[model samples]
Target: MEIRLAQRVQALTPSSTLAITAKAKELKSKGYDVIGLGAGEPDFNTPQHIIDAASASMNEGQTKYTPSAGLPALIKEIITKFKSDQGIDYSPNEVVVQNGAKHALYTLFQVILDEGDEVIIPTPYWVSYPEQVKLADGVPVFVEGSEENEFKITPKQLLDATTNRTKAVIINSPSNPTGMLYSEEELLELGKICLEKNILIVSDEIYEKLVYGEHKHVSIAQLSPELKEQTIIINGVSKSHSMTGWRIGYAAGNQSVIEAMTNLSSHSTSNPTTTAQFGAIAAYAGSQQPVDEMREAFEERLNIIYNQLIDIPGFTCVKPQGAFYLYPNVKEAAKLTGYKDVDSFVEALLEEAMVAVVPGSGFGTPENIRLSYATSLDLLEKAIKRMHDFVESKMKA
Candidate 1:
């Protein structure tokens, strides 16, 4: 029987990051020593306190389904976190806890967007943003973030992209792939433009806690009371607390949107895992030491590996200020090494050098490649050396 799949499923592109990671794993399973730089989460384990909390919840029979939105306790902790970190305030009714930050965003797009509504996404964006928007029946309008500007779009670019059909704009600071952060002044400029255009702001601050030296993560919603009302924040403990497997994330914004998402989730996913909610509560309310330690380690790795990456012939990388990924322009290297594009270069790297990194094409920047520094310095060093040697061999050929 020939089955007709839904158009949405047919149109969706599988995440390239996950694809590369899987390929690397397949090779490793077959006894090949493949060094993978495609990781999207912290290499660290979830804090023991969070694990204990999940165990305690299960032991106490808190394993039953939670409220579709989230546990009141977890919501309270989320509110406290926003107040302390971003200086943003939200009522409990305005927040919805989903399976993870990704799900939180998926729900947000579903609730707020109508068919034909256009979402302005700045490139190079997270691999999931455009796909998620398309899945929700919204058109994604791409605004290029040039490498010269550190991959950030200017206010003028945002203004030019706005139209009658523009429903929202996504802002991912400490952005995935590039790991570049937007300064307060820059965010204020962009927020003002969004406010003037009456476009909603979907701020993805999943990497908020992972910022590096001299750079602070600013929430666009925190810029003003008006912006806060117009913005929806997407955050999770996955990156911050190394709780990716816990599958707990939350969205904070307009009450109407949150209620609608909660209603949708009730029918769709029910509630986020009940035990994960308890664990997330511990993540937010527990000691800050573990989070701090992880951030320190990532920063250390970034500092060490970034120098080596830039020194490689034909590679140009801007210093990443946050997140765990480094997106380096490899177009010159590809051209120098006789490959047609970064994707081809990446494939050869994986097959020949036994190293895995995500090609930038999936992130809307074909001239670059994203290498995650979330792994240990030892593994990172090995991966970079392999990549360097691979490039050198190509140049000689």
Candidate 2:
């Protein structure tokens, strides 16, 4: 069978995290006590008020499809959230709500990128960005960032990656897999370059609220009025409100870009779930005490796991300022483990220590592994202990 799948599908790679998680689940079902460190979301419930709002909407017969751009009320809520949290301002008409942050990003590519268009992405980016660019018939130009630089790309590097065909650049602060957050000044410098180059910026700020220490998430659009006009700010309540299942992501950008995405939405998903939109409205407009409480807990666990990783031999990790993941370079450990690479190290950990982790190759970096400390403190401590023991054994060998 020739199996006529779309050519775009051929360019896409499967999610490494979900693959690991499925394997972990299989092993656990077979009576193995697998400690999963691969999941990217927090192990918390959606806030009560948000849940209530969804129920209320459903009871009120708000089950019909919303406008493709999203409910005007929800868009208004998103505007308020951006202004209050990231100091970015946008009119409701500039906002387009979709299924999730991922959806917004993919749609942004479809709307802006033409065949052979180039998108400058920092290396070790989210696993999906490169694939998304390819799916949209765009080329992804990677600018490598080292662990020494806190996994952030420099302005010079950004400039070098640009070409006349460059369509956009993605800025993910509190980045996933690495958890590196960019400072406000750093973003301003990059924003200035984008202005000079007349390049579009796709700012993924889903993890904005999860940052720690002095690292603040400043939307590059907020750097100035000109930058704002050229930036598409992608965000959702999934990370902030622990509302992953709600699927209420949105983008704020130039009216034309937003309108194009809205038209795309009209043909594809039509709209996000109506009840979820109502709940997201409450998530934004209601009290934010729940989000703050969860952030505090994550901060506490982050400190514990980070301090432990610093003491482990043959392993090095940058203290992630935001997000729940820690990307530790395990090349030293890989050499000791009789494993050829990061994939083998991850496999050995899961098989020997019952610990599940994502291989960094999925995010364009081998010789590293990603561990999510989004679980409870007890599990995080135990997972770290097990990982430490595994590394010690490797070193002894």
Candidate 3:
């Protein structure tokens, strides 16, 4: 029997990052030594205090369904977090909790976008942005952020891209694939244009706490009252607290939009898991020392591997300011190694060198590949050596 899939999903591209990760796992199961750098998750477990809080909630019989918007107590914690972290205030009614940060974004698009509405997604974006916008019957308008500019779109570019159909522009910092962050001056400039055009700013700040060196995270919503009114912030404990498996993320913005998202969520997911919500509450309210420790470890690993990665022949990379991924342009390496393109180079890397990396075409750029340094420092060093040895041998051949 043949079943027809929906047209909405027919043109949808599967996530390239996940596809390679799955392939690596398959080879590992078959006794091949495969090192996967395809996933962006933290290698750490959930903080013990958070786990204890979740267990305590269950023991105290707080496991029933929560409000569609979220638990009132959890909402309070989110509000407090915004005030402390960004000095931006969000009232209780202005937030909606969902399954994950990804779901938070999906729900926002569903509520705000009508058919044919356009969202300006900067290039080298998270893989799901375009697909989510399209699933909501919206058009994705792309503006390329070249490597020279650190992959951040300028305000002039934002202004030029503005059209009557432009409903929102996503600002992801520290970005997923690129790890670039927009500074205060940069965000202010872009915020002014968004204000002028009356376009919403969808700020994805999931990696806000993962910044390194002198780089700092500045949320566009914190720029001004008008900008705050115009921006919808999407964040969660997945990256910040290592609670990916717990699945708690939320959105904070305009009352009407949040209420709409909350209503839609009621019909869709009912509400996020009650126990997970409690865990998220603890994640925000508990001592943040563990988050700091994890960030420090990632920074150390990044410093060690960035040097090794660039030492490979025909490879050049921009040091990331935040997040755990390293995106290096490998076009010259591909050419020198005799592969037709970066995609094929990546496939050969996995099949032969036993290292899995995400080709940049998945993020709308084909000259580079993404590698995550979320694993131990030893594994990262070994993986880079494997990649270097592979490229050198291929060049010699």
Candidate 4:
């Protein structure tokens, strides 16, 4: 039987990060010693307190479906979290919980966009943004972010990209692939342009709690009350609380937009996982010591690995201030080693060195590759040593 799938399904690109991780797992299952540096989540377990909360909720018979938006108690906690962390106040009615931050983004695009609406996404974006926008039948317009700018686009760039059909702009500070962050001053400048143009802002701050050193995470919505009205903040416990598998995330924005997202979610996901919502409540309302410890660990790993990564022949990288990924430009390495492109370099690295890393082409930068440091320092050291030996051998060849 011939099956006809939707054209949109045919147009979608499978997530490259997941594909590489799965390949590494397959090789490991075959008794190969594959060191995977492609993961997006933390290596640590979910804090015992949060896990206990979920268990307690289940024991107390709280496993039933929640309100479409979320349990009211969890929504209140989200509101309080925004006020305390970002200095932005949100009422319970202005927040909606979803399956994950990824789903929060998908629901936002669905509620806000119409056919032909353009969303200006800065390049080297999280892999899912453009795909999710396309799923909503919206057009994604890209603005290239040069390595010189630490992969962040400027206010002028934003201004030049704006069109009458532009409906929104996405800002993912402490960005996924690059791990670079936008300063408060930078965000305020961009916010002014969006205000004048009436463009809605979608701020993906899922990595807000993962910053290192003196660098701080600032929500664009916190820049001012006016900008707050124009911005929708996407975040979840997936990264911050190490609850990736629990799938609890929420969106805070204008009341009308929140209502629309809630309505859409009702007909689609119904509600976020009920026990997970209870766990998320404890995550936000309880102690934050575990989050702090994980941040420190990531910082230590970054400090240990960054110098080693840059010391490799023909490799260059911008030191990331937040998140756990290092995006190093390997174009010179590819050229020096006789590979056709970064993708080929990545493929050969996996096959020959038994190391897994994601190519930058998937993240809209073909000159680089992303290495996740979410694993142990020992594994990281092993992976980098293998990579260095592989590149050195190619150079000698």
Candidate 2 Cα RMSD after full superposition onto the native fold (Å): 1.1
Give the lowest summed-lDDT range of ten residues in model 3: 153-162
Query: Looking at model 2, which ten-residue stretch has the lowest summed lDDT?
Result: 305-314
lDDT of 2 by residue, 185-292 (tens): 898899889989999999999998898877777778887889899899999999999998888899999999999999998999999999999999999899999998
Error in Å for residue 44 of model 3: 0.6
Model 1 over residues 288-383: C-alpha lDDT tens digits? 899999999999999999999998899999899999999999999999999988899999899999999999999999999999998989999988
Model 4 regions more than 4 Å off: none
Tell me model 2's lDDT, rounded to 2 decimals: 0.90
Clashes of 3: 0
| 296: Cα error in model 2, Å | 0.2
State the lDDT at 365 in candidate 3: 92
In candidate 1, residue 191 scores what lDDT?
90
Give the distance in Å from residue 242's predicted Cα in candidate 3 to where it truly belongs: 0.5
Worst 10 residues of 4 by lDDT: 79-88
Candidate 1 segments exceeding 4 Å error: none
Candidates ranked by lDDT: 3, 4, 1, 2
TM-score between model 2 and native? 0.98
Question: Per-residue CA lDDT of candidate 3, range 154-218, in tens?
Answer: 98889898899999999999999999899999999999999989999999999999999998999
lDDT of each: 0.94, 0.90, 0.95, 0.95
lDDT per residue (tens digit) for residues 255-314 in model 4: 999999999999998999999999999999999999999999999999999999998998
